[model samples]
Target: MKRVLFSAPSVRRLLLAALACLSSPAPASDRIQIVTEELPPYNMTEDGRLTGMSTEVVQAVLEEVGVQANIQSMPWARAYDIALNSENVLIYSIARTRQREQLFKWVGIVAPMRWHLYSLPQRNIQLRRLDDARRYQIATVKQDAGEQHLLARGFAIGKNLQSSNKYAHNYEKLTLGRVDLWIANELNARYLARRAGAEVPVPVLSLPDLADDDGLSMAFSLQTSDALVERFRQGLKTVRDNGTYATIAKRWL
Candidate 1:
């Protein structure tokens, strides 16, 4: 015959406890922040929103697993630097290197690339070995994998002619003889040649496997909790096992 509520002091205490728990981040959740560059066919913006093959793939995987994360677009160097120091931030589409092999926890393969060296017509330098690069100055976009790969291999590269406009100006550097050779991805070189109305080599030279570097994946922050990394890894395996990853890959590639 009577309905009574908890005492005022008791109710107040309960509310405060609940609020504290809600405010605290999940043990596995580190408030993830992702930074990506404007590399086309991978990460780029459309109508001021982030959208591309790698971008879409990462967003989908995170959403499927119900993780709260944000992706930011910025210059490649800046993004990479920030990701290195910031907690829970990852630089997507990163290449694997001996120096970086054990640094970050990788999630899933996002994309693959077939790298090539492009030369302007009539000036194509022959390359049969990695040592062949030493004889000529190579061109690459700044802080790009190509740049890192070449420089690390002890080849002298031209000034960091790398930019988001890599495709547009790279050919000029080679054609005008600014640099001896330019390294480019197959798709990007073709895209640029078509837009510039210039001719790219009929057959791009393949540099013997500096690194496989295929399969783009999220690189979890070193500061990210192991539990979170493991969770994402598990989630990725689930997606892959179910063919969800392949399905998503087909949508873009």
Candidate 2:
């Protein structure tokens, strides 16, 4: 069984921090700037713009609560760097890890990301235990939680393949005898697989569910005002209650 490091206690701490931010004063009313990568089933680009479940949920909630929002897309690593250095900035659907737990003010962890791995079924590759993955050349996106997990466990990964949306090319690499394993979110990997017609059945290894605690969060800067973050949080709640989140997720997933 894969043990998820972030459980109830750490999640409660993050929530408490969010609550504290919610009760404080906001700095300015300019616009909340959010940055995300162009990844599918979470954040994807259409017509050269970012639109997906996480994006739609956040945008709808902020609009509903009367707060202005500006969203942009960049590479995942670059987006994270921008969010860290820039003010009035946030990132979405970010996994909670030891490195990121205390980095920023947080809000609206909509749901836990169900993560897994895929390998050719005929190869009989299985990862019932994380230790079983050490021998294979695991491939994942740069700066993703899946990579982080494997690295922490001392798994030596393969070469840097190309960067494509949703690890689609990685799946192709595996199919064409280029890689041993592909690590990504369950829903996201499946979506990408169908998009590429890589219908070769692959084994998926399930990880722990973190819905009650380690779901997606909008991580804000320390300098951002509390009131504005509170507004977005409340707006996210309104969107969820009003079924905007569910609707968008249904349409996409």
Candidate 3:
């Protein structure tokens, strides 16, 4: 084949076209927004950057799939809402409950936390099951998984459920007797308690009847593509197999 030499104007046009193609914005699907709450050791903002166990795992997953992550630190309620309505959005360290099973496409179960009802040791509270404790006032983080779980179980607000925006406030509420019981994750409760300088007394009730294996997964919006979700699933497995997951978990857990 004979080579055709380009004229000056043709060369300029070709160069400009190439430059435009190179500088064009990446497709929206190539970038994903990850929303997470400030739950210590799992997901939180440190020094103005998102970093935690779940965060690290998410980062590793994104790296494996070769996608960019735009992480946002927000309240759990707001993040949960965004994940429900937004496309190409991800919410990490969320409880995978039966009520939420069909709402989102799950990547993988990243962590497991035992749910519990905590109270002061001196109170001598007694509960054989979650229902028995329903008569007493319970403090929960607003829009948290525990709060949603309680609501699904018919725990009425203002009657038995007390809501707080911050997780630490629930601890304070429990300690001050503002609420009879505080519903929280086992690890998160201990972490927040130590941070708040509050003592969570013994005799805590494990909510096995409620959720024996409460899995925390990075859930994607329903609008997310199956291919994208599968990519993340494989990425998670890769990290776990390559020991990246364990390394990150050790640092935070």
Candidate 4:
């Protein structure tokens, strides 16, 4: 080929263009902030490391999509707020609700969760209906799906509802009799109860209205691009199809 060389001015222009590209913001997919809460068997920080069923599944999905993010575990309230106000932020194991349907772009469900009222066996707390829970003090993680669920059903904070930054705090309060009821998923309640080293097992009370089955999913901020959301959705399917989802669940479930 004949020699083709750029003029000095052309070379300068090319250099300037490369600098501009380097200084520009990252693409939406590369800016994702993935967040989760410390819930055993799902997501948690142990021995200064983050690992759990949901964490592994999320990692697998991101790998399938060729995306990477630091999966940080923070208080549920703070994590929830960050996912709500910031662009390119994703919160995992979030319960999908009608009220939140429009607030965020939801990925596929990660796991199934069922909420129940837990109390000490000797407490004899009778919870036949949802309203019945209102008569006693209840503890829940701040800004958690269970807390929102109760709030939507008219549970008042600082009165019948005691919100904590961590589920362990609520379990402690429940075991101490400071809170008459602990609102948590069946798996979480059992996990927290064991972790709390409770001498007596916390028994589940019947709450017909609150017994509905719910699911946890990765929810992206409304500001995230639709293409990125779809990528994650499809990546989740890939993991499930490849049996990675089952393998992760087996490790925890």
Candidate 5:
């Protein structure tokens, strides 16, 4: 039957405490969500563990920054969509293109990439220029750098471009005659071919216009804090400077 009311000063102090708690930032570990796809020699699941050149480099960066986060492997389209829309999500082994410059806060280049249009050796597909290949059906991973690059150059899906969820699936389409050509980076094309116990797809055309010197990079979603992005950028630099990057590259590349 008794009620106690807080004094004005006490109530003010309690309100200020609540405001501070509400405004405080979330912990780094709580905000970061690392995602990547099955891109061989860079990011892939091998022997039931996530291990690759870029994955190792990213792990080193996380250690350097003292952040513990688990990397999840998913379909490239799904991972790309999550990174594009989610807050504090990190995606790796992603090519840095002019089209993607403003989309995310880039950490740094983790590995090299060279785009190419590949086909079966027997097909003898030859192209003197980029547009020459438009006559054939080209397989591309959905939302992948190669696909985006071609799409920017006016390649359309369904008509000429066949979009798939995985790079390996594109390669399969090329080999099975379902698609006349597959656009992929040099390392991924060769790695997937070897894994499939098949001959390396012949590179019929090189896409230098689509390739960037910055290579594939680790990047945080645009919603990520600038401070966190810079922390990762510096962490990546440390690994590159201390010879860790070279060692990892030698193992995979």
Candidate 6:
């Protein structure tokens, strides 16, 4: 084989081309990361597959948008942090709140949810108002909308608020008398109680002040491009308009 050498200018051009290739960003679809937690009826891992109401809705939107992504299930806190700090990240079935309005680019609503303060019937807990419950310890998931809402209203961790990593843990705490109240969404509370082979806990107080009337939504990290976010928003709208959203909701809700 004959040895060949490039000219000085040619070598500089080649280096520049290589560096550009190395530094260029990946395609939007390739960089996108989808995450969720095991908040059932919305998102869950069953038989090694990720499936739920919101999961199905998200899948439908992905199909509508012609984007393919695998959903990963993890603890809510970890998932929330990843979505909050990472680029091109998508989190589904997250409650849309005023506190989180500027944190991420909104995609669209996934499901309706109502926050409530729950207690076992035997406990007979009564709450005439939000402040009335401050006397008792409340169970909440760390970084969850419920916890954030309560914290905003003066519920301090290790004081009157007991934070946990999982929603199931909160249920366990409430049933074992470790906590006086479990602040949660109505659908999630009912699902957890019934799945544990126990009677559904009583919704002692409706948290209208902290209610997320806009419902749960699929959101992309703030670093995502406006075009990509709009694609997902339109995809979600397509699913809702074409009845795919309702079909999924009817099956799960």
Ten-residue region with minimum lDDT total, candidate 5: 23-32
Off by over 4 Å in 2: 1-29, 156-166, 209-214
Question: lDDT tens string, model 3, 66-133?
Answer: 88868898888899999999999989888877778899998887876778888888898988888898
TM-score quality measure for candidate 1:
0.79
The CA lDDT at 13 in model 6 is 100
**TM-score head-to-head 2 vs 3, winner:** 3
Report the C-alpha displacement of residue 182, candidate 5, in angstroms: 0.8
Candidate 2 per-residue lDDT, tens place, 56-109, comes to 877787678766667887777777777778888878767766667676777767
> How well does model 6 score by local distance difference test?
0.90
Tens-digit lDDT track of model 1 for 130-231: 666666666677676777787776654334333333544666777677767778766556655765687765334785464456555578768788887777
Look at candidate 4 and tell me the lDDT of residue 207: 39
Candidate 3: residue 102 lDDT (0-100):
92
lDDT of 5 by residue, 125-166 (tens): 889998898899999988988999989989899889999888
Model 4 quality (TM-score): 0.87
lDDT per prediction? 0.70, 0.70, 0.84, 0.82, 0.90, 0.90
Which of 1 and 3 is ahead in lDDT?
3
Error of 6 at 231 (Å): 0.6
- Angstrom error of the Cα, residue 228, model 3: value is 0.4
Residue range 1-253, candidate 6, lDDT tens digits: 9999999999999999999999987575546999999998788889999998889999998889888777899999999999999999999889888899889898989988888999999988889999999999999999989999999988899999999989999999999999999999888998898899986789999987674455788999998999999999999999999999999989987
Candidate 3 minimal-lDDT segment of 10 residues: 207-216
TM-score of each: 0.79, 0.78, 0.92, 0.87, 0.87, 0.88
**Between candidates 2 and 4, the TM-score winner:** 4
